[model samples]
Target: MKVINLFALLFLLGCVVSCSQPESGITNESIAIIPLPDSYELKPGTFYITGQSSIGIDTSDAEMAALANYFNEKISDATGFSLPVGNSGTIVFQLGDYKELGEEGYRLSVLADKLVLNAYKHHGIFNGIQSVLQLLPAEIKSKEIQAHTTWSINCVEITDTPQFAWRGLMLDVSRHFFTKQEVKRFIDQMAEYKYNVFHWHLTDDQGWRLEVKSLPRLTSVGAWRAARVGNWWEREPQLPTDSLSYGGYYTAEDIREIVEYAQQRYVTIVPEIDIPGHSMAALSAYPEISCTGGPFQVNVGNTFYTKTENSLCAGNERTFEMLDSVFTEVTRLFPSPYIHIGGDECYKGFWEKCPKCKMRMQKEHLKNTEELQSYFVKRVADMIRKKGKQVIGWDEILEGGLAPEAIVMSWRGVKGGIEAAKQGHSVIMTPTDHCYLDFYQGDPIVEPNTYSMLRLQGCYKYQLVPDSVDASLIMGGQGNLWTESVPHYRQVEYMVWPRALAISETLWSDAQSRNWKFFVHRVEQQFRRFDLSGVNYARSIYDPIILPHLDKENRLKIELQTEVEGLNLFYTFDNTIPDVYSNTYTDTLTVPKNASMLRVAAYKGQKQAGRLIDITIEDLKKRAMEPKK
Candidate 1:
């Protein structure tokens, strides 16, 4: 038997192979990614193997270079391979478009002499990498390496692409500014999960995070705020020492770079500029645009549900002109097909009382405040379409009248998406119940802070398409991370991973071909990916937190929350064989994970679920270690 030197090899390849479906459910064989034209071919090799990238070396950005090198080293270390000297003898894996099937199609084909890695774009490359990680042996997957060989696979054909045209992740940067590098790091993580869209919440009541050439103060004044004394969630008294300088916006060049990087990965960045509502950030810098024309600070409180005075007046031509200029600059910066106009939770109390708003509503003959919001959305949608772009907004966009070209994102639930699709408009699913990552995965009593209801398995088992809806109007789905509470990068990583892996499988895998047992095994393999990569993940406490509620049928039901690709769920009364049809959950599941015969399920999408977890009472006792006081 050959001894596996995983440490050295894994460190070289920069990834650790964890688990694989062995013939008898246990074996130690090193699985190496053999580059094929359309897919990866598994080879049982004894020598050390390393994955090399064409990305040139840079010294100035040592952290970036180190990250790349670390990946290379880990893969090699796990496989017991030595780094090639002077780039000679390194397997030259050529990256190209492997569109043998269609968009998002990929394949690893092995011809006579070398390996070829091909995909539609960078995101495909990311997916291919995850797939390669799956083929590795289990010991390598679970933070250990094993030795065995005789890897083989029947030549198979795969026609794969994202389930939803828009698989996205939203990040709210207005509340807290993350460096450009931090943003890029987040993008890297998103790509790893095969999420193809990045919804950037760039502006909010806390601060403005984009620079408009015409609106100088937007960055100069609006972006900078007096030092925030306390957490927005906590009602601590403002400290006198609270100073007036606490933020920065992205420069056009910065955005251009970010856009290019995302483009390389086939990820579109949808930037949101709140209109009519969430305008405090803008009004803070340009007081002239406000009907009151008084100095305003970045709204520190949750005034959205309570106040009505901040609404942009439709009667004011300057309001339209300002929006025109902002949209013009925004359109020029982001070439995405759909621009997001936040239309959720706008308090109409201000519009009802404002002279400019009342007069304008009368002039336009709008029936009510809802119609006015619809009008505002349509006006922006019109401007966006004039520049040749579509528009997407929250469920609130459906309130007044959805523009023909506007796509509705059903964050509230499938009702909006179903309604919008029935109306012939495309819809992206982002129902907060399943896709909000900011929620606590474990019991709130155990791990307090997050407001979302998401857990690892919940993220894994999620289906972007509701069962009753027609498939034609479904554009795709996305996960949102509204960082009212997440203040650091590590927190972001903790909430996203494993779950994002589930999402990847969900988005990429075919709906009909899922097996829960296989998915659990796959996630088991991915644990090595997270452990070696230093990604801190939420624990299994989440299972009991959502399971008790899911086990019963109620008006409010539970849905499998996952974004992993290629997952399947299995359940059994006897626990012998999994019934895919009867066990599937469309709403809140009332079933228990530890029931007489609860079994693992498969997720068939680009999203991935975490491990096969059995929740114990002890699970509820665990808490996320808080930062030092």
Candidate 2:
């Protein structure tokens, strides 16, 4: 074995200290084959980076100066190209011409020791910077301290690009409010992870978070609400006394600014205007839309209100007129090609009891409640398509027969996507089991216990393609962060990162290029990045679980070895977080009532490590955690 230098190794160790690792070394080849170091010597010159003319810079923009200063610092730290006042360095990067290079836009080439990073857009440049950051040492990327003079390049040539057209993260701003700066910070994180789509859930039952100039009440009355009492489904009903209160929405200007910023990072902001269901916020603003026209108030404190009979307002030309106007403003605000018309869990009990709905069903010769949902969805889809946009909805949109030219977001599972795909419709696979970011990764007790079934490893191991199906039907995948309990920016970041990073690589990196070991290394590196950026990610306790190897007879066992202190193992074959004091290690764990998936978590004092096991257990305790469910 080669004897490594002590101080350098110690420094590197410090860099990776807090990011505890699996004692067993990484076995993946991609991670095992890092280029050996040749030399660390300093000799460089001037470097220049430019953007497309649309950016309009002439060495006068302060941000340009800042960008230059940042690169200057990086060069000094990594390649020892320190210059005094007027020394023009040997390296120069001319950045410009921002445009989408299809899917293969990311490219970097070193010609005669001069590194050139090129993309059609500034966002491409940002992605290039992220790749370069990965190439450097963890210490260098973290910049614990910038190097004075010591840099060398050994002829590196790289042409990088994303595999999927859409690598996205959806943040539901309706249940929670994030400040403008906070939204930008999330964008920064997205860019860091090479994510290119930001699915902004702008409205829901809890709040209408976007400002509509035509209707001030969208922000004034609809946006405000009384403090929530408890779980939305189980809160005690307070009397319908007059109490108006709480929260704010994004003004149109605020949204424009946000969109522009995200555009700079090459992230398309797709606004989700929940409809059919999750429309209480909108209904509250316009009582005329409700079947019951009088005294309809926002359902504050999680009280589920009966749907008003005025749902589609059949024959009420006025209702269609209102929707036309509403969507007009919506389309103007969000330029994305596809708009989300939330069509899940509508609880059409009100429709079942409404006279207008009954009459419409009779006149239209519709069969049942599902048909009404289909009718409502199809009309909205028709309306949106007329406005030069396509409509996307939850898998439920597939229930009443899908709308023509509609994209199916398969949240329920791969079945919906598979059905839609076979029909030749585009499908975004966000199966709640593997793509919902809100679900606890491990034992329910350890995580917030989001009703989702996806774990980190499960997410990493998921294949977007359905078995024996055409790959062309797949549009990509998204990890959704639905905020029922999460209320702040810190909580948002905590729930998104690390796990989302895993999804990022799974989506962006080449499938053959993937190595779990390299991914873990990069994850540890990201922890350092998060620390420097002041992001509130979860502790190391909730790591990806490594299953014990099984022998020929299917017997499983492995030595429980770790150097960390105060560690404890608590597991449940059934999905639940194990209590530290509860010494419950049994052969079988029963699936708790109403539970759909099994999970477990490990923890030490104040440090919790849990991951949702992607194992489907019919008998509660007899299933093994598998790579895929």
Candidate 3:
């Protein structure tokens, strides 16, 4: 045993205080794996993980070796031992021919004496180990060694094969740049959920996050902007005298390191150098590429619509020259099969007005600005394909015509994806209503302010493949965390989790086996793991959904419902805060005759489980005027 220092002692005390409180009342008898396995069977016994246990694997395989080491590192906090690999061990990992199970599929059997894991590829091993981690007690994720505790998993046989190939999460680093370490932490959590892709939105109107070594200004100028913390599009514009110290960019070495880090977890980092539209950062760096050249600053959240500098000058030869340089450098850094060229929201009015654009359109025999955009997209696609890569764009890429061999990321809605699939183009569906994580997942009054609401149920309930489209053309969907309002990493975690878990299951687990009630139970299990892991997660599901409405007499009436079953909603109309002792909501009720306000809260048993919603009677009337479904 090692001597415990003061710092370690305090940390253990903190973890102990938290670990004492388990997250849910759900029974441990069931195996609760998120993005639930394709099939599993509960057996009669349990496999206990003790100090004597060792992790077995073929160390000769570098991937397995790293995975084994990672697994050991993670569990070491609780077990207090480095389990040797490829030796006598209770846990064993083996890779063999499992074509039926697919590349990321695995088979695991945990018995009394020993546990065996079999997978065809390293990615399968990576995913299999995550399930193993979940099997252990939540305390196993603690930062300190757990003494007098049994780190055991139930005896079971699990066969998991993802139904979708592109299980992914897109982190928009452009709106708010997360540090390289933070990005790694995000990927680590995504990998644990069996997500195979990390779509990195590297550049947008707000900032450029990746360095193009040849085009130094892309970082020196484009990657920075004046700080503004109010509403995203309502912030005051950046002034010339303001200090541009709010942003940062990833260097070439940093990009390489992050990419390799993701690769180790079997995650492909798809870089999105968003262009044509959302190109204000690039335009700010090199104003020569815009229709109205010179004097363009990196956007400061305020809408710069019709300014015409937000989009790249599609007709300029210099724009292609700049893009070629950036694309060449991008291809050099990332080895992903596809690169995202943002062709969404490009204001064509500027293209229609520019002399260079008119000349190019005439030369190319194009009719409208949409065809001009198509020409630019086709050209950009050709440039990328020449570098041995495919192009991916927002649904707007379908605007004149989608480039040949291009992948469409349908952000507007499924309509675009369906159209793309019908046109024989691959589509990654990230429709804003369901897949946009940046939207408020809970009641916006208490949740972070955002444009829309995408509740966990809404995301989980969505059918990924629209029956109208050819299923083969639909790759998968991702939860896009566009961070205009998420200013830090913890907020990022809070926004992503629980909801992102819903996305993972929708994309990986077989649709037939997906159960909403059971999935909520699994989410509760994950909450405990996150608690022990020091990861931030939202408790919004426990919050009551408050809906204001007009009575037959046009009186103020409100309805409150909890998403998680059994969470009691308490309300008070007398201007006092509500607790567990307050009046419970059983049915619809109108505001009191002279009550000035209504305060509602949610509680699990005697403990507060959600944010308190306070609404003035006047505000309730306003909400009732525009009732939400």
Candidate 4:
């Protein structure tokens, strides 16, 4: 070892003191906290929650007192122990002048006898309380009181802060309506991970999920679609005997309840009202506003018809009138400073052919249909700004030219986000490859059929902020769970978790501090918590991704690798199920002659760890030849 100078030794000792490893009992391997805190030091001992303990808050501050009461209620519901509100107690929350803590950052200290939380804002205090809950037994998340459960927390000091201001999860409810209670539960889970934004995709081609009082037909006609089962993209058209009602929308009162619930958890709901394109539901309610003036019905299927006319009539003044009426009610219901006017996938072919559209193009001296979309987006942005709110749109809003005051939600890819940042507009990075939870996360044979592949590690490994873009303009990132294939809340939970947990840490924790192995360990901890809370989560991380390549002799060879280590992979060239006794995967194996299919599975010791993956030999060869995305 090299000798160190006295000053160097002192600096090293200081680092060791400030950044010590977590104590054994505090950072339990069985229950790791998601979105790991900025700085934490676990001390010996624990803070036991007894019947005598009470929650303390400043009664003068109504907001703080309410938050404290909320925590008390949750604890009481969980552990069968009621914590009364008092001026002094073992668990204390206080607002202090900690300017450095920021709005959503807090300092939490747990001593042997007392647990103290200090923050400058109520949002920070709420977040600190979430951390306290996580520190307790996983049973604390149970709705019913648990018998013989120890309500205690490890003694630790945590000064936690988020890396980004905006950490979000978008739930697309238009395709399949989720109940108000489900939405609240979603928000509650998101809050535990420090996600502050809930991007509600309330409108889409299939259905409209938000009610506009002025536009009665929106809910009356657009909210109900023909019931379709099986694959969403391959569903058959509705017959006369089929049920024409299979959807629901949130009433004004329902919106208020959900919004207030989110506010208490410090989650801002950004409601998305897709326009121009994906307007089939809207046009079904008011067909005169479309380029093709005829009757239309809410779409029950997921196929995007290229020849069909679904976009709004860009040239019609009636289109703007209808939009203004709808938006007027939307702005009143949602208090978010930024309103998402979906500017994505608007097929402009109808506008290119319509007489009114051509006339408007001539009047405005617009070159192409792309410019018409830009015009529509800019007009909507202006209207929304006039209502004291800014506009956020899909990356396509930059097709012809971006509005001067528009924010971009880059979903197609990071390129749009980069361009938006370059153009001096803020961007939220939600590229599909990393953030789209609807994509198939495991072996296509094992998981439900969806679009593309996005492994859990792929999400954890994403670099949200591109180096070329202005980092300041990069607001944050979000994961979107489109529900075309997910008809139930259980499937939604299955697709979002683990992956959402990865995205949460990506947005909240420092990028340099990320370690795949460490994160997976934490994920396993969350799995146990999810089990206790009756939440579904995917465990596809244990599955191995098969990669095929041709050897020097032109013989096809297959390679397999797991995301994490220690899992043994087994394979069979025949159409037989793989077991512990099957051929162990080590080096690349030659494609056996006369073998039509290959099956593979992973095992931890003697138990099967992941779903069995089966692939046809022809498909394997094609995959080998295709370039990786």
Preferred candidate (TM-score higher): 3 or 4: 3
Please estimate how well model 4 matches the true structure, expressed as its whole-model Cα lDDT. 0.83
Q: Which regions of candidate 3 are displaced past 4 Å?
A: 1-29, 138-145, 627-629
Distance from true position, residue 232, model 2, in Å? 4.7
lDDT values for all models: 0.60, 0.61, 0.83, 0.83
TM-score for candidate 4, please give it.
Answer: 0.92
**Which 10 successive residues of model 1 have the least lDDT summed?**
1-10
Residue-by-residue lDDT tens digits, candidate 1, 474-501: 8778888877776677777777765666
Maximum-TM-score candidate:
3
Query: Please, what's the RMSD in Å of model 4?
Result: 7.8
Order candidates by TM-score, high to low. Answer: 3, 4, 2, 1
lDDT-best of 2 and 3: 3
Model 3 TM-score on a 0 to 1 scale: 0.94
**What is the Å distance of residue 473 in model 2 from its true position?**
2.1
What value of lDDT does candidate 2 attain over all alpha carbons?
A: 0.61
TM-score of each: 0.72, 0.74, 0.94, 0.92
lDDT of 4 by residue, 192-234 (tens): 7889999999998788988888889888889988888888778
